[model samples]
Target: MHRTDNRHAPGASHNPRASQTHSGGSDTGHQSPGHQGAGHQARSVEAHRESVRELLADLAGTGRTEQLPLREALGRGLAADITAPVDLPPFANSQMDGFAVRSTDIPDGGTDLRVVAPIPAGAVAAPLQPGTAAPIMTGAMIPPGADAVVPIEKAVPDSFPRPGSTASVRLPATENGMYVRTAGSDVRAGEPALAGGTNLGPGQLGLLAALGITQVTVHRNLKVLLATTGDEVVEPGSPLEPGKIYDANGTLLEAAMRQAGLEVLRAAISTDNPEELTAMLRKHAPAVDLIVTTGGVSKGAYEVVRQAAGGQDIEFLHVAMQPGGPQGIGKFDGVPFVGFPGNPVSCLVSFEMFLRPVLSALFGAPAPRPAIRARLAEPVESPAGKHQVRRGTVLPDGTVRLEGGPGSHLVHALANSNALIHLPAGTSALAAGAEVEVWTL
Candidate 1:
């Protein structure tokens, strides 16, 4: 693993079931004081990303492995190099349903040769006499003395003669090794088929199946503790009160984590009470690889996560980015903790920008989303000092049409969007047709 200046490895490896906290993080003993102050300084998006990467540089994966069947290995990372146990196409075979012949037997125009017994698939064949032709099916083993195959369509008198008849068939001149699949031509035994850290996709799995691999060793899924907070938030299946609404952040964040190949354990909604929040954290934090909570990091009186985490080493601060400015990051009880803003869209955006990249860097399985250049379909204004991430739809003509405004509460618009238009901190406005960076959602 590549080491950054600020990153520190988890001092010791812990078993998956161990509840003890592994020591990790920077050895510098201090971070900039601005990280804990009330909007003292606006931090760049890249700075926050570096902080995340520092935490993930050592926690790349759990370093555990499991054996899974080929069908279950889809999307999993290979644990070790896979070497071919047997040569592909273990024997020479015919490439067409034609006649197998010696290249020496063909005359200048054509020659009628005695037709011997036919060789169907899955059976051994008799050796060809010097002046005889043997009928062979596609994929059937080539006879010992035959060096080439003449397609049935190209045979003179162009069809197979009767089985019991003493008919001699004519074939045109052919070169040696024509239309024959040679043994070991694809992959030789003991050759490496795939390297470690490769993501198992359809093609990779197919190759393993073709090589007769029944089981594979893969890395274990990442274990995460997911929590949601807010007094006004209620679970989805419950009845809604006058001022409370169904909670969307929990389900949204859970789905995103799972889609990124994480094993998530979502806790019940943590209300505005600090004691309840702290209790939930202490109960679940030590047992998981990482802890993530939605809401309760912004500047509000009911910020339960920030208040409860005060005694711990967690820091609450603002990032110079739209939709997900108020954030919290640090270690709690020796486990990495991330606090996202409460709004539905804010929570989702934070995961995409920070957690997703960290996961990609760690496991190397789920690839990063593609970034493309697209023209703006209409005029749009951005804040002077913050990077704006706006939901949008990419038109067929390579233009982006933004959805709702920049407010973090626009969950409906977020659901309808398929792309995100990124306006850097220095960009204030863009006219129609201006090229912009678009990240597919």
Candidate 2:
């Protein structure tokens, strides 16, 4: 997205300087000759994570809010505190299908009162006469001067008389306010209904509906520009060409971003040419708040992303982590940019480790994954200097076993796993039954 570099366009001749390998070391499971001489030191996983966090720090607290229909606001964060516009129920109402009467009309033992008329739900009735009871249905507005309700079962006949028919029913003495829902009892008018930052779920939307709110103001979803690189990459459903594979990183990262409540604008696949990649980025940079690309950040000679990022503010570097170590974090055309490694497992793991947490902390979406302590089912060894993240199935007995070996391309194994086994850097080996920290996927 570097506008100053017209040399990195689609049809421009390749620059000799771009042929030189990037300084970001490599993710080939072994130190490369380029990394040894490039003077780029590999940063720890936490350091790289912090770099990504700081790069996109401006996304937090932007105070941007949008009014959305209540149905569409599900799972969105509330932008402001919501107060009830009117009291719940709005008026005193019946809580049972019974007769409304003045509590003092009945004596200590019992009394017979004349049934004046029936009051179904939503009906307005006149005040109760001295010794008369009005048959009322559940949720019917309580008539004026009615202090209590006598359930139909408590009456002598245990049922209401025919409509407009004069009849007498025996009832027991009742206390004032019995079986009556008073106005503002649940929530008063102008009272705080839901606080800011609340996640709008089914219960929250139901409350808003009860408060007569058809829409809500919530934080706007963050927009992201996602791109994937490599000439060998092709979209799924197309005829497979020689040495070509379906593009998994684009779909994988796009789904992950959407799960985090991010609106994604996925760019077309970029070829090995740095010029075309740079041109694609330039075209999409203005519409998104952040840009994420997969592949082309390693020490390989055909690393188009690294080549295109040359002389730009973006920095390509290595993180001390297994499966997903090569990373790029900085700004592209004033928009935050993050470049993840090419391998499907690595790309997904990169999002889980770095981007997911930052999004949760910043925008309060995609609730954090559950991390727990589990015992190792078998002994395992890891690289001496890098953090190893292995796919595992956490068994019911609190023991976890590896799903597959520590390979960045093991997508099948990743699919069978239910959790990520986090083995910190510097821990070369661990024995069976040893407790380790695990994040449930």
Candidate 3:
């Protein structure tokens, strides 16, 4: 399904892994996005996401495997290993419309024989008597005691060898196994057909159907606590103050979570209240798989989220990417908490570049498609020290053009963009027509 045509233009920077040194101060440290404390630099998006992925892999530690019927298997990650039920084509059948006869009889004058009862499909006839011929249909089981089939056109029609009719008949010469489909020919009964951990798509489902299975057990879906935090944001329909805006991050994040197939338990919007946020999390952390909060993890003074999650194992870190530099990851209570930047654009960008990919791997599905190379619509530049994921669109010739500025506050621009063009760290401006790589949403 397509989302509404809302997106943002991209901003820029270099990959974080470029150069470890930044000429910031005499007493030097890593040049992190000055998010939490000035001296504590943030990790690059790549570095941070790798750590997060490792955490997720640990969380997804090998689950119990199981078996399931094919009908209920759509989109499910295979739990139990599956083996083929039986050898395909359980019996040998004729491959041509012809007469069943001993090959020796066909070369002699007495090759003709009387036709007995009709051998249509589904009826089991007694074994063919020697020297007598039976008519066989395509896919019809070859009667036992018969040596081979002579095509219909090769012999006389109606009954058997007549008194006046010549007993001699020309036989069609062919190998013994010709026109025969042997039992267990296509597959072996005990062979593994589907392995564990494969996501069951239509083709996989069909295999189960062919095996006559009707049910399949899948792993439980990831349960998530979805929420947005900020005092400046108001719910829809409330009067807009000079500095207040409607809460887009909550709605947007929830929808994206659903798109990624995580079951979201909507946590209420929390103003910059540390105690309230902490208490709420304390109550629900035990039941959720992940606690996702947007906003307030930044270095700003009113970092309510940072305060509420205080004293826990959580550490708020800035990543190298612009607009989304502010991020927080720590264990809230017992469950893992992922703090996204307050800006609407930043939250979604962090998701696309980081969280979503981890979720996809855990669920045994393909990661979101990455952006492709394209020509530039115009010229642009970045602080050549971070991997910049910029919002852009494909032109008529498949080229990607910049969408907007690098400011984290530009929700509209990010909303209007369909893709992010990534530029490596330590490199600067690109003139029109320069090549770039992109990751499409």
Candidate 4:
């Protein structure tokens, strides 16, 4: 999905009030006089993404490593190449509950052998006598001098031979190494078990456990400082006063970052006071690798993020996209900062379009979601110049239906949707059955 197709759009609209300083969202394709011409910078989605990629390449993945217990290492990035200390399975073992015997000892036409001992799953068995067989359970070590095994089902009696009483298990003829899992058959000792940058998911963790590895080296989770700014926003549990909305961006972004494998520290809501917001950033700036603040980067008079961080290296811009155009990106006090619009839907969209991809490229922490080409189930109109991002549900018939309007405040609609439908720039409308790019959320 690292594509740079100008025709493909993100499908969300920016608040017109937020982009008044530059070009409005409706003028996404228009070239303004002062910003146009030879000195004009490319403001396309791909250009902005390239800048983000450059910033991440310089800031993330510091090549640092930490040793953590296996239990705590799941979903982390493996920091170094790992070589197995011992062969997989370490020793020749049975692949099933069966009888272990030397192939040469079996009768030429296949017959029963005197059963000497029964080896349970964990026990080490005495060497099998030349003419006798040992009852071996799956994963039990193959006794010495035995090169073949006949599964219990293949035995003529199809049952376990007694441990001490005289008995024999009939088995059909078997090759020399039948049903015997040899040591090093999976992976040899001193060979690579996992490469650097591997994400330690369930299967990867199981491999380490199989190797008896209790501790592993991995990249420490990136610590992020998350803040939300707005005077009208309040915590969810608090009683909602007139004209006040519960702060959802803080919780939304925090959960998204945590799910992507970052350690998040949520700060208290920042009121629309520049000085107080500025102080909050200064206090937590040094403690985290990245700083993310939602709300207050727009052109509104009370936009504390712009008032407080305007003098910093951050650049506030109207990306040629919908529902999330007001964006701020830069470094403050040597820490990376990303400011998103206050709308719940916009906050989530900004994170998915920009931050998530950067984390995936830098740390190999999040596996990218699959994107599919889906036909539109209904007609929809979009602005001519911006890529529009709409929340929708993909149907069983391979079509997608829009969930809500282009407004950024439609949080409920977003919750009901499972995909983001993309409408490319320059394309104003599409009818049903028109193919569009859809990103699974």
Across residues 338-373, which tens digit of lDDT does each residue of candidate 1 receive? Answer: 887777776778888888876665565665767999
Candidate 3 lDDT, tens digit per residue, 181-268?
7776765688887876567889888877766667765555678897777666788888988766788877888888887667789888
Which residue segments of model 4 deviate by more than 4 Å?
A: 1-50, 58-64, 103-109, 126-132, 231-244, 298-303, 366-387, 394-401, 421-441
> Which candidate comes out best when scored by TM-score?
4
Against the true structure, what is every candidate's RMSD?
Answer: 8.5, 8.0, 9.4, 5.0
Better of 1 and 4 by lDDT: 4
Worst 10 residues of 3 by lDDT: 19-28
Highest-lDDT candidate:
2
Q: What lDDT would each prediction earn against the true structure?
A: 0.77, 0.80, 0.65, 0.77
Encode model 4's per-residue lDDT on 95-128: one tens digit a residue. Answer: 9898999998877688878888788887877888
When summed lDDT is taken over every stretch of 10 residues in candidate 1, the lowest stretch is: 19-28
TM-score of 3: 0.69
In candidate 3, which residue ranges exceed 4 Å CA deviation?
A: 1-41, 61-73, 86-192, 365-367, 370-377, 431-435
Write the residue-wise lDDT of candidate 2 on 182-230 in tens digits: 9998899999999876778899999999999999988788899999887
- Pairs with steric clashes in candidate 2: 8-275
Ranking by TM-score: 4, 1, 2, 3
Model 1, position 428: C-alpha lDDT score = 78
